[model samples]
Target: MTTAQAKTFITLFLAMLLTSCMVADSTPDNQWRIVDEGAYAADVSADAQLSVVSGINNGIHVWRFGEAQPLFQWSHQSEGGDQSNNLVANVHISADSLFAVTADREAFAIWSLTSGEPIGFWRIDESSIRDVAVSDNGRGVLVGRSNGKVMFFEPESGRRIEFLGHQERINSVDITPNGRYALTGGNDYVAYLWNTDSGQVIHTFTHPSRVTLVALDDEGRYAFTADSQQKSQIWNVQTGEPISQLQYIARQKIFTDAVFSKDGKYLLTGAPSRRLYLWEVATGKQVGEWKVAPRENMSPPSAVVYGVGFIDDKHVLSVSSSGLAELWSMP
Candidate 1:
């Protein structure tokens, strides 16, 4: 063959090989369904039985894993009975799946999972609500605000506890299944594990940049904290000591959501780049990894992994901003 023809052939082959690799990496080994076509946000219950999604219009829908239709549809409305103009930016289901919490920037509402009805709705007056968590059975509610305060409230008793440790906007928060302890992170570059009743800090985890994500193991075994920069560490909840740091080769690996295994042996984390990772709790080694598919005809061909949970010992599930729900076999 002529030299020019040989060069052209080599370039074409290289392009084909790159394209094939991209396709393979973006496709999951197993996908369950497209839970929501264009959901703004989504969250999965810790037991993996149900999922809650926020649609473009800020309406909320709850779906059982095997069901085709959502069990409930709800929307936040104004006092005049008109739909609120704000979009629902976050939705989380309780560990027991008995209730869920949805929050836009200015308000949050609790819903009953069984009856599919609103339990109560509350509005924030000072600053926007950045993140929220509901303990099992909806006995306790926690919200992190843009004004650096985290509030833990009981709907039945009208008791409230405000945490004023953070000096900057609160970014993430989680509570124990029993609603005893709370884990929170903030733009002040700190993660605090504190008491829900006293609001006294138990342990302070410092980071180099803003702490963007924090999670507590439902069993109270471990705590996971990550910053906007490169540092991510797992801590022993009882001893208040660092267990191990997530060892990612990337300079920065930002986690949008995380859940611990029931046995506390493994952790599942989701990232904004459609990346889901399974890590060993003791070693912090990445044992498994998967990439979720992007939205159809997306310009950048990327999706944010909104939530992840363990379906069972052998399988894990993830929901992405692309509105896709997938089940994956653990490695």
Candidate 2:
């Protein structure tokens, strides 16, 4: 071949190779870019802004999309005292406000999103708090403890109201959009629906496995639960009946968490094998799947996830054991 022709051929071949590499890496394995790293992120929520609570620093960090650095950070130590060792179980942002619970076993705090100043703090029971959910009206917050006790507090007044019933450590709690009902799950392999006004258990549903996570639909008609025994179930909020259940994909093994779309038409689950599954609510059909690659310093098997939240109808934010948090856009 002529020299000029040989040179052109090599250039074309290299270009194709590079394009192929880009396509391969562009798959689910690399689609998620790290939003935060180095700290053990416990909970994440988004409203007008994105918020993350890190157990390592016992701090709440806020990020506005398009900004290179966090807009601000609020830490437990800022409230005065040595709370560095406390683990933050959850962090939430609502109507420009932020709330977080410290792992010190009894305290929860509120903050102002705009100013990053501590607004108020309260102490619940002596048991470690496992989960927290803020009411839709932004007036109340529910705190779930390791002893299966749930406390409702008026954020402004710091008044505490107790709800009793579950016999094991409460793992998850979610309130309805109208602030009338709440669903809580725990180690007892059951979920209880409570009337917010009366603080009474109105209904209960049992699962074959430990219910690790729970989420209420935007309309308050349905409650979704993810269990450790490899399944996710949707319950009719009023009837206390499970209307549908999705078995875990056999190869994946562990089902970490589940969340419903804002419209309640779809459900999403995160698996231990670094896979995310999307299911149709009515038909119980698997609609989509995406895989997440383990971070560099993290081992695959031990990188189990415990948190998943919808960024919108078409995207989700997930956190893994390696403290890597990323946002995934859905298909």
Local accuracy of candidate 1 as per-residue lDDT tens digits, 1-331? 9999999999999898777544246455566554445678889898987888887643777878867777888876556644655688878888788989998888888999999989998887788899999999899999999999999999999899899999999999999989989999999999999999999999999999999999999888999999998999999999889999998756788999999999989989999987888999999988888888886678878888898989899988888877778888888
- lDDT tens readout by residue for model 2, 198-226: 88888887878778878777666778887
Tell me, by TM-score, which candidate is best. Answer: 1
Residue 253 in candidate 2 has what lDDT? 44
User: Each candidate: RMSD to true structure?
Assistant: 4.5, 9.4
Worst 10 residues of 1 by lDDT: 20-29
CA shift at 95, candidate 1, in angstroms?
1.6
Clashes of 1: 0
**The candidate that achieves the highest lDDT relative to the unseen native structure:** 1
Give candidate 1 regions above 4 Å deviation: 1-23, 29-36, 81-84
Query: lDDT of each model, Cα atoms only?
Result: 0.87, 0.65
Candidate 2: stretches off by over 4 Å? 1-37, 46-49, 55-58, 94-104, 249-255, 271-273, 300-307, 311-314, 321-325
